[model samples]
Target: MYDVETRQRALALVAQGRSLNSVSKQTGISRAAIRSWQARPTPRLRRLAPCARCRPAPGAPDPADSYAYVLGLYLGDGCITRPPQHRTASLRITLDDAWPGVQQEAAAALRAVFPDNAIGWARKVGCHDLKVYSKHLTCLFPQHGPGKKHERPIALEAWQQTIVTAHPWEFIRGLIHSDGSRITNWTEKMSGGQRKRYEYPRYFFTNSSADIIALFTDALDRVGVEWKSAHQSRVARNISVSRKASVALMDLHVGPKH
Candidate 1:
C-alpha cells in the first residue's frame, strides 16, 4: 500500500486537471491506483510541500573517499583563498591544459564534497582550473596553509588519515592524477646477441611537499604498491613505481590519463 501522503498527492494531481495517465506517469502511481485513491470517501487532500531530498543536506560528512580524493588533489595542485569577510572560502585545482579528464575528475570530486555548491572551470595560460566556493571547503581542507605546501607544515587530520587508510587507491589516484603521471620508459638491452629496445609503463608522483609525498608513499605501502624516490634535485621530491607488478597495480587504480 502506498503512503497516505503519496496517494493524496496522486489524487490531487488528478483533481488538478492532469490526465490520470499523465499523473500515473509523473508520480509513478498506476492509473488504477490513482483512480481508487480519488474514489475514496476521505483521501486526505492536504497540500504537500516539496520533498526534503530536493534540497541538499547541510554539513555532509568529510571523511569519505570523495572527500579524501579531493584532499589529495588539494595537497598536490589545489589552492585555497580566504576572503577578508571570513565567511566563505574558495578551493581551486589547476590541471594541465592537455589533461581535460583530470579537470573533470577534480570537478566531480568537489561536487561530491559540496553537492550543493556549484563547480566552475576556466582556462588559464597553460592550465585548466576547477573552482568551488563554500564555507565548508575550508573546514574540509584545513591543511591549506600559507605559501607553498612544502614551506608549510602540512598534515592530515585523524579522520582524513582514517579515510586514506580505508581507500588508499582513491587517494593515490587523486595524487597521481593531479601531480603525477603515467609515463613510458624505454630501455635497450642485448637479446639473442642483438640489441633490442623495449618500452615499459610506469607511474611517477612528484610534489614539492615532502609531507605530501610521504602521505602518498604511505598509501602506496598500505596497498602493497611498491614505489621509490626518483628525484635528482633536493628542491622537489619525486617517487616512481617502475616495477612491472607495481606499475600494473597502479594502472589498475589510476589508468592512463585521457
Candidate 2:
C-alpha cells in the first residue's frame, strides 16, 4: 500500500511540469500508478494556510523585514515553479554550502514570512537549494514567469518596493548572499624604499538582469554606499563597491559569508 505522503510528493513534481516518466522514476512509482492517482482526486492530508497576498485586504507581507531579505535572495537567483494545473507553487533559493550560517539565516527568513509551510533542502554541486511550496507564491512573487529572469522584463510592484525601501540593508544583504561576493585584492607598493604589499577589500555583485542590478545599486544609494558598474558581456554586468567608506558600511551589514 502506498502512503499518502509519497503520493503527494509525486503530485507536487508533476505540478512543477516534470514528465510522468521522470516523476515515476524519481519516486520509484510506476507510471500506471501515477496515472491512476492523477485520474482520481485524493484530498490533501495537509492544506497550507491562505497566503498574506491572497488575503482579502492583500497588503504587504507581514514581518516585511524578512520578506525584504527573501525578496533580495529571490531576485538574485531564486525561482518559483508551478504548473497551471496545480494550486501549489514552489519557491526555491539557491544557497552556497560553504556558508551554512547564511543558509540557516535564509531558512529562518523564509519561515518568518511563510510560517505554517514546510521548508526542505535539496543538495546540488557546491550549493544547497532551499525550497518551500505554497498556493500564493505567485501572489507573493508577482515576478514569477516563464523563461530566464534575464530574458524577461523584471520590475518591482509598489508594495515590494515599499518593503525594500524600509529594509534596504536586509534586501542588500540577501542579494549579496545569493549572487554577490567579497574579495581582497593586493598589489605591491614602493614605500620607504621598500616594496610592500597593500591589500584592499571590495564587494561585487553580478547579474544578467539589468533591473536586478539597478535594484541592488538603488539600495546601496539609500545606505550612502557608492558603486561602480561595468558590463562583462552582452547580458551580464558587474557592480563593484570598492570605496573605503562603502566597503566599511557593507562590512558592518554584510561581511564575507560565514
Candidate 3:
C-alpha cells in the first residue's frame, strides 16, 4: 500500500487537474493505487469554519515583525489547503506535540496575522496542528506551491523581502525554532594528564530546499553571525553555529524554548 504522504500527494496532483497517468508517472505509483485513493471518502477538515462567510477577513499589513516570523515558520513546516467543493481554505502548521510552547507561539502567530479568523488546534499521533483559513494566506505567503517545496521554486514577494531584510534576526529565530534546533555539545579533554569534560552550545538548521537554506544563510549573514554546513549534500543541507560569542548573541535574541 502507498504511504499516507504518497496518497496525499497523489490526490493533490489529481485535484490540480493532472491526469491519473501523469501522477502515476511522476510519483512512481500505479494508476490503480491513485484511483483507490481518489475513490476513498475524503474526510472533512475538523475545527474549520463551515463556509466562506465564517472565514475571517482577508487583509493584513505587510513587513511587520509578526508577519515575517509567521512567514518563516510557514516556510519551514506548514501547508495550505483549499478543497474544490469547500468554500473556505485553511492554513495549517504542524509542530511537535511535546512542545506546547511552540504550539502556543504558532497559534499566537496565526491569531496575530488573522485577528478575525477562528484559529484552532488538533492533535495528530506525534504532533499538534495549528490551523487558520482565509484567502489572504496565498497573498501573504506567496511561496506556497504544489508538491514538495524542495522540488519547486520558492521566492519571497517584494514586500516579504522588505520585512525579512528589516527583521533578519526575528526571521532567523522563527526558522530555527521550526526547522532548526539548539543543543549542548560536549567533549572530553586531557589537561595536565587529567581527563576533563567540556561543554558548549550550538544551533543547527536542516532543510531540503536549497533556496530556503540560502535564505537562512543570508539572514544569518545579515545579522553578522558565523555558521557552517555540517556536511555537503544536495538531498539535505545541515548548517550549524557553535561559536561561543555567536551562540551568546543568538541566545540573547532567540532565547531558548520553554
lDDT string for model 1 (61-84, tens) is 543788778877888888998878
Model 3 Cα shift for residue 250 (angstroms): 0.8
Candidate 1 clashing pairs, residues 3+ apart or interchain: none
The segments of candidate 3 whose C-alpha lies over 4 angstroms from its true place after superposition are 1-63, 232-234
The candidate with the higher TM-score, 1 or 3, is 1
* Tens-digit lDDT track of model 3 for 152-207: 99887676777889888778877887888888999999999999999999988898
Give all candidates' CA lDDT scores. 0.79, 0.90, 0.79
Most accurate candidate by lDDT: 2
Model 3 lDDT-worst window of ten: 45-54
lDDT (Cα) of model 1: 0.79
- Ranking according to TM-score, highest score first: 2, 1, 3
Q: What TM-score quantifies how close candidate 3 is to the native fold?
A: 0.74
Error of 2 at 34 (Å): 33
